[model samples]
Target: PEVIYLAGIIDRTPSSIAMRLVNFASVDPFHQNRGIAGLSGGKKQVEPIWKEFIDNKEDLLFESEKILAEKESVSIDKKFAHMLIGIENLVGESKTREVKVRVNQSVFRQIVLANYSSKCAISGIDVPELLVASHIIPWSKNEKERLNPENGICLSSMYDKAFDKGLIGLKLDHSIVISEKLRSNRIKPYYKQFFAPLEKLKIASPQKYLPKPEFLEYHLDVVFMK
Candidate 1:
């Protein structure tokens, strides 16, 4: 139904759109690794766009959103009015930078959520309101990778806080590792009911852009409690 609606808006057949999606999947590394051969004929057309996304995610993602807004006959600012509310008073480079940052952050969240199929990677929570695009490497610590899909993880609010605060971490194998601080509370009801069950459990693999091992190492070295 969604594909049909999109096809109507774009004046194309639903099959065409479906095939295009398959083409995109063909170019996706995750699908490639899984031995899924999606519409190879259209792969070349989508490959360049995928390369551009990997090379310059922030700019490409913002431009894509802007283009979508234009296609809908709306201004980018108006399309993201709620998220861009507080920047009205600013102008010039400062305003431009702020707008780009906010828009790109929103795009990052969308990409991360889609990667995880809109479910929390750890707990499989499917409620969008309870999910967050948690950064493996702190956003402030890496400007170049701030918007990288590989640097993000979908997690529920509770686990997001736990991961952010070093109460829990992920090993190179993607298994959960409880901090000694959290482990100290093992006898507590909450620990037994929540934290204990997660210890050494592997997170659900994302559909695309698995978290980079380097980012996981950074989190282990710099953020995880001993």
Candidate 2:
């Protein structure tokens, strides 16, 4: 029933629906390209649809990245592209949906990295290998908003742990806000040295990914552990 309900809102066909699902799963364009192209060519009509979706989806993704850098929302068409991703989930029995979600997810990470200069947005620590573009909103919680760049943050291993734990959080204004619970004598000096300085840290100047306040609120209430 839910899938049928989901199908009503789907604007694209089943194959395209599958493609979008696949795109968000891995976040790798090269992989997605290979997978999308692997489908049988005898289905000529689907080809055009797939091609259009690929082009439009890439365009929309890049546009979203640009807006994230600018700390703004994508233009209307671009926004529609994102909104239309739901169609991918309803595409009959096709595998494209699974692959699309993966590819797009990879792209999302790259966008977040570039936007934050491959560094932790809060601590200014630059360690590409150890950093992750962590989601402000967990992926399982909101399917419609999952691909959104604004729902993510770039943080190093330690800081991500702290952020995920809610030992600290960022103000809507991007200033630092250490949870009052963490201000105790048992607090690690490392917290004082690294995270404490962050209390005054200006939210990283958004490049391609301004943090979304709505998801940030989720962090403050649920995921931030504090």
Candidate 3:
């Protein structure tokens, strides 16, 4: 329940355990890649705890990791369900819904990652830590599209941020669209070598859940800088 208790068991400081959980969540290299939002604080902390457990799950002594994984998964699922219902019921009176939103975002990322085969659609970066589940339409623009995998794309973190800030966009053909504004920064080696080279390069489309054209249209109209 308390970090002190966990610290004693693990022979780590309370603060160290807490910080290490963040590190564990940061680099899962496994199924789900959790950002700080999904991995830090309260009920969502269980996700990171599981992330740590998974890192050490390969025990030769016994199936300790397997046991903990199943146990924690069940507990987290039940607790998360109750937490969501509670937050939904208390929407106006409390801020618990924010936690639910974080969980939803994490699940949304997992779905998008699966859709894109856990690599960046544009750069083909396979490192989970470097990829992001980017929304075609800005998340703030469409509530319904927030969790829709068909409205998501896997992009490397740089490309994701670039797409978000509209340093780049996608044409209807799923090709890269670099903004003319980048011309000023084009002197940067990475800009010329990596970013500029991406212009007109086609993004990798999902095999199972193709992104919606309307979402692409919305992104082009509202989010894309040019």
Q: Which numbered prediction scores highest in lDDT against the true structure? A: 1
Rank list by TM-score = 1, 3, 2
lDDT of model 1 at position 200: 77
Ranking by lDDT: 1, 3, 2
**Of candidates 2 and 1, the better by lDDT:** 1
Across residues 40-143, which tens digit of lDDT does each residue of candidate 1 receive? Answer: 89877999988988788778878888887887789988988877988999999998888888988887888899999999998899999999999999999998
User: Which prediction has more favorable TM-score, 2 or 3?
Assistant: 3
Error of 3 at 151 (Å): 1.1
Worst 10 residues of 2 by lDDT: 71-80
lDDT per prediction? 0.91, 0.65, 0.70
User: lDDT tens digits, residues 1-106, model 2?
Assistant: 4334334454446665555545443343444545544334334545455566455664566454445434433443353354345454565545344434555676
TM-score of 2: 0.54
- What candidate 2 gets wrong by more than 4 Å, as runs, is 1-102, 185-187
Q: TM-score each candidate.
A: 0.82, 0.54, 0.60
Q: In candidate 3, which residue pairs get closer than 3 Å at backbone N, Cα or C atoms, i.e. clash?
A: none
